[model samples]
Target: MQIYKVGGAVRDRLLGKPVTDIDWVVVGATTEEMLAKGFRPVGADFPVFLHPKSGEEYALARTERKNGRGYGGFIFHASPDVTLEEDLIRRDLTINAMAEDDQQNLTDPYHGQRDLEARLLRHVSPAFAEDPLRVLRVARFAARYAELGFTVAPETLELMRHLSESGELEALTAERSWKEIARALMEDQPQVFIEVLRECGALKVLMPEVDALFGVPQPEAHHPEIDTGVHTLSVLEQAALHKQPLTVRWACLLHDLGKGLTPEEEWPRHIAHEHKGLKLIKAVNERFKAPKDCQELALLVGKYHTHGHRALELKASTLLELLQSFDVYRRPQRFEEFIAACEMDARGRKGLEQRSYPQADYLRGAATAARSVAVQPLLEKGFKGPELGEAIKGERLKALKAYKEAASV
Candidate 1:
């Protein structure tokens, strides 16, 4: 059997990127032959093996045919007769279809290297439309290579649009969809992923809450971009620029869902939108089955991002309440992430992308001051049970009040 280093390893190496994962394809190898060679079978749906020493995946050269729906509904054929060229042709993107031999000989049956030079993400064949997951994969690749000026080929985008319209995207499981969404959110240019999905209409199918924001108007004074959708993408960009965590990025994306529900008569003024957007955020969380931390943070940002923006103007009691809402004392890191999300929202507007967000520092300071209030002091005063809880709240409020007064000067 002849093994060839293939897919992402070859593609990234050609682009001068640090190759993180290396995939191998073995041609002229049957399942029995693979077992006899000491490779451990790992893939449940396909003939993929694990190298005993390196523990890297080594899949047999295989061809696939669409058998049903979604990405999982495929029949794979892996045998000694499967040719390397045949296996390469079945890959989604041309740039990911090339292979390299042990002797450093390169195989480019699909001209992946040409597309790489062109900085284009092109499909390998018309068979690319078979798996709906390719739409997400291509969008993710677009996000990954966007800094390198790579773009999806027009024809490939057409196929993605077709997949979105075919209702095949609806067949994707929440787990599979969220896996891509979460990974893409952590990319350097995650906003591009959402834009690509919106362009292909997949956003409407997979994330309609976000899709509804496009074309929706916002106050031009506050949001120079004026479009709620544009602002959302801007917030995602800001989150990425700050190297925020997935929870922060996800919260930033969903922070303005209520603005999409503004009445036409309201036009630019979405009064009470922060409270109005909570249910929609819940819908998104339920649909994606996001992690508990992500869901809670999204909801908090959705329900109180305006409060975060108006932090300095809020009453001391309200400030303490907000800090408590975030459970700042127990999970200070999560509260910090929440602050990051809020800052991204403020910086998301056009012409304000680089503006400093003093509110973040103000909130963090308030949290620190409030947390510094000693419960032991109340205990020393003989405060106990429910009364002690009330006394602690009173002291925290006092601390926040003092902090607010000091900052005002």
Candidate 2:
């Protein structure tokens, strides 16, 4: 059996990128042979094993036939007779289809290297349309390598548009879709992911709430971009530029969804969009079965991002209520994440990216000062039960009031 390094390991190496993981394809190898040689079986869908010593995955060279619809409707064939070229042709992108042998000999039956040099993301074959997941995968690769000047080939994008209209995307499970989306959000140019999806119409199918924002108008004075959809993408870009975590990024993506639901008569003024966006955010979270922390943070940002933007102007009682709503004393990290999301939103507008967001520091300081109020002191003064809680709230409010008073000067 001949083992060759394949897929992303070879692709990234060719691009002079840091390869994080290595995957191998074992040609002319059988499952029985792999077991006899001490490789541990790990693949559930096909013949895949782990090296006994290295623990890296070793999948047998295989080919697939589209048996029905969607990504899962496929029958995979793996045998000693399967050629490396056959396995490579079945891959999604040409850039990912090349392989390398142990002797450092490179195989490029599909011109992956040529496409790589051209900085184009072309499909391996016309059969690329068979799997709906490739649409998301292509968009993700675009996001990951966009800094390197890579773009999806026009023909491949046409195929993606066809797949989006094919009703096959509906076959994707929430878990699978969320997996790709979450990964894309963590990429360096996550806004491109959304843009690609929109270009191919997948955004309407997969994330209509976000899709609806595209033509929606925003006040040009506040959002120089004027388009709600453009503003949302800008926010995502800002979150990525800030190197914010996934929770913060996710919040930025969903923060303005409610603006899309505003009445046409309202035009640019979405007076209560913050409160209106809560259900949309919850629906998205429930649909994706997103992690609790991500969903919670998205909800918080959706419901109260405006409050954060208006931090300095809010009444001391309102500011204290907001802090209590976030349970800032117990969940300070989440509060910090909320502030970061709000900052991304404030800066997301056109021509406002570099503008200062003093609201973030002001709110953070308020949270800190409120948390500094000593509950022990109130309890030590013989305050009990409801009285203790009331006394602590009073002291925390006084602290926030003092902080606000000091900031005003």
Candidate 3:
């Protein structure tokens, strides 16, 4: 039997990208033969096995039939009669269908090599429509490979549109959907994937709230055209450029989700978007089963958009009392992450007149500076005893407020 590297590892290596996982196809080998040759059986739902010596994944040549729905609704076969061409046909993308031997001899029966060389994303076979998850994968690939100038084959996009409309895409679990969506957002060009979702009409199914942002106009003083969807996309782009953490990136995308749910008549004149936006983000976060940490970031971004105005108007003692409740000044990354979201929120417009206020920069900057001097110093001092602790706390609060005000100016 001959073993060869196949799928993503090979594709990534070809593209000069880092290989994170290794996959192999064993030609002219049976599962029993593999086990006899020191491979352990590991795939119960499919025909996957692990090599005893290297522990690398090796799947025997197999074919399948749909027995259920979504990703798990399939049957597999690994027998002597199955050819590498047949096994490759079962794959989704052409570039992923190629295989390479230890000698690096390419086995590309379906022009996958050609597609990769051409920097195009194309389906392996007409059978691509049979699996619903491929739609999401195409969207993700668009994001990950947009810089490479890859375009989805028109027919494949059309098939995705059909599959999403038929509700097959909905059969996939939210966890799986979120995993793909999150990864796509992590890509350098997230807008490509998002735009693909919009083109395929899948955004409505996955995030209908976002779809409402398409044409919603904000006030002339607050924004030019102020389309909620445009603002959200801009926020996402800014977060990506700044390399914000995933949770913060998510907050940026969902921070303005409430604007879509608000009444259009309120527009520029009576915008209480921060409160409304936070509530919608909370519901969306819950639906995605986001962790408490992520939920907290979303809530903070929502909460503090209006807090700056309230803070600017408060007396020092009152403001100190209010800010003390958060302790956000103690955690700089948390505060910076919130600011990253806010900064992106503010930049999502045309001119200065469109801004909600003087931008959230002053508040975010002030908070960051305060946390750096006060919280970090206290932690570094590491003083013990009740009197020392109280002294540190008192000094920190006093220093934090002054630092914050300085940053705002």
Candidate 4:
């Protein structure tokens, strides 16, 4: 059997990037032969084995045919007769179809190298349209390599639009869709991922809540980018630029969804949108089953991002209530992430990206001051049970009151 390094390993190497994980495609190999050679089988839908020594995945060269609908409706055929070219043709993108031999000779029958030089992400064949997952994969690749000026080919984008219009994207399971969505959010240009999906019309099908934001009006004074959708994408860009974690990025993406639901008659003024957005965020989280942290943070940011923006103006009691609502004493990290999301929102406006965001530092200082009040001192003054809890809260409020006074001075 001849083993060749395939997929992302070869693609990243060609791009002069560091290769982290290497996948191998074995030609002229059967399952029985792999087992006899001390490889461990792992794939349930196809013939994939782990190398005994290297522990890297080594999948047998195989071909697939669309058996039904969605990404999972496929039948795989792998045998000694399967050619390397045949296996490569079944892949989603041309750049991902090249393989490397032991002698370092490249087999790129699909002209992946040509596309790489052109900085284009093209499909290998018409067969690329058969899998719905390719739409997200190509968009994600666009997000990943956008800094290198990579773009999806027009014809391939047409196929993605066709797939979106063909009702196939809806067949993707939430888990499958979330996998791509989460990975794209972590990319350096997550906003590009959404842009590509919108161009292909997949955003309307997969995330209508977000899609509705397009063309929706906002106050140009606050958001020089008057479109709610444009501002949301800018927020996502800010999140990526700051290298924020996934939870903060996710919050930034969904924080303005309520603005999409605002009445057109109320254009440019979503007076109570922060409260209006909480249910929408909940629905999106429920649809994708986002991680508990992601769901909770999204809700908090959606419902109280305005409060974070108004940090300096809020009354000391109101600020204390907000801090207690976040339960910062128990989960400070979540509170920090909330501040990050708010900062992204504030700085996402057009021509205002470099503006200062003192609200973040101010709120952090308030939390620090409130927490510095000693519960031991209150207890030593004969405060007991519920009374002790009240005394501690009173001291904490006094600390915040003093902090607010000092900051004003």
> Which residue pairs overlap in candidate 2's backbone?
none
Candidate order by lDDT, decreasing, is 4, 2, 1, 3
Cand. 3 Cα-lDDT: 0.75
Give the per-residue lDDT of model 3 (tens digit) for 1-409.
8788999988888899999999998878877898898888896886688888889999988898888788778888888778888899999999999899999898888888788888888999887888887888999898888888888888888888888898887788778877887888898878677778888888887778777777877666656646767767776776777677788878777776767866766764436677777767877787777777788888877766445445455444554554454566566567656656766666666663234544355555445544454445556677557866676557756765686566458
lDDT of each: 0.93, 0.94, 0.75, 0.94
Model 2 alpha-carbon drift over 4 Å, by segment: none
Residue 304 of model 2: what lDDT? 92
Model 1, 326-356: lDDT tens digits are 8898989888988899999999999998888
For residues 1-409, write the lDDT of model 2, one tens digit per residue: 9999999999999999999999999999899999999999996889999999999999999999999888799999999999999999999999999999988799999999999999999999999999999999999999999999999999999999999999999998889999999999999999999999999999999999999999999878888899999999999999999999999999999998898899999998998998899999999999998999999999999999989998999999999899998999899999999999999999999999999999989998999999999877777789998988889999999998899899999
Candidate 4 Cα outliers beyond 4 Å, as residue runs:
none
In model 1, how large is the Cα lDDT of residue 263? 90
Tell me the alpha-carbon RMSD of every candidate.
1.0, 1.0, 4.7, 1.1
